[model samples]
Target: MQRDKAYVIKHYKKSLDWINNLRGLSEEQWRTPIAPGKWSVAEVIGHLPPWDMFVLNHRIPFLLTDERLPKGPDVAHLNTMAAKKSREQAMEETLNDFISTRRQLLQTIQQWTNEQWQHSFKIGQSEMTIIDYFVGLINHDLHHFSQIQNVIHV
Candidate 1:
């Protein structure tokens, strides 16, 4: 029932690959400067956690909780905080959180229908559907994935 199963799965596979590639790196490798003054792989991983967790745990479920967007724009701040930690700590907790939440996000996507993908709902300032948010998530990942590769010199 996924509207575009091929498209979804393709991106899903690509995302999974990018995540896995990071996981395969050693702790030092993860913290290596991936870009000039951007963020290391560990920080990038830390940055990804909320994309899934906030969407699943707060935003979607809290459709009635409040109009406030969940896990809004504080991620850069969070990444800054996580970056302060040693690579070991960031990878263990922050990176793992991304893996956990992404697992949940993929699981959630499995239950969606094509129509459900774009079903509009009100949130904060504008009306958008789950699909819009999910698309944002995908794009965010891709954009950062590029940054990660650049930083890691991979």
Candidate 2:
């Protein structure tokens, strides 16, 4: 089912607000792992932007056109690369990159015509609306956000 654009946008905004809560953490806090053998908070922050960039540059464009949706990159490889890059950057820099990329995505989405929001795109054998794509994005953000929160609380 197609979700209302306004409702999806509201949830997206709420997710951003939750991410903003990370602003006050110190550098060490940002780098702390949520659990052994898991990603650190900065790496979790690192993990997010590539997907937003993909949605902005690839998925959204494909949804607006007749182009086949591209297969996603290998998750483990992508996350490993992102984690390495995140560790190399200053915590604040990594955080800003994620926020900036996400904001750009929001701006792009806000400009979409109602029809664009309702457009269906194929992913492998399944299909989903543009709003469903946004829902997936929000779910992704929350997943990492929860990881950060859990690590910080430890």
For 74-117, candidate 2 gives per-residue lDDT tens digits of: 88898888899998998778878877987888887889888888
Position 139, candidate 2: lDDT: 74
Error of 2 at 131 (Å): 1.2
Candidate lDDT values, in order: 0.66, 0.80
Looking at candidate 2, the ten consecutive residues that score lowest on lDDT are 1-10
How close is every model to the real structure, measured as TM-score?
0.74, 0.88
Stretches of candidate 1 off by over 4 Å are 1-6, 62-76, 82-95
The TM-score obtained by model 2 is: 0.88
Candidate 1 TM-score over all chains jointly:
0.74
Question: lDDT (0-100) at residue 2 of candidate 2?
Answer: 40
Supply the global lDDT for candidate 2.
0.80
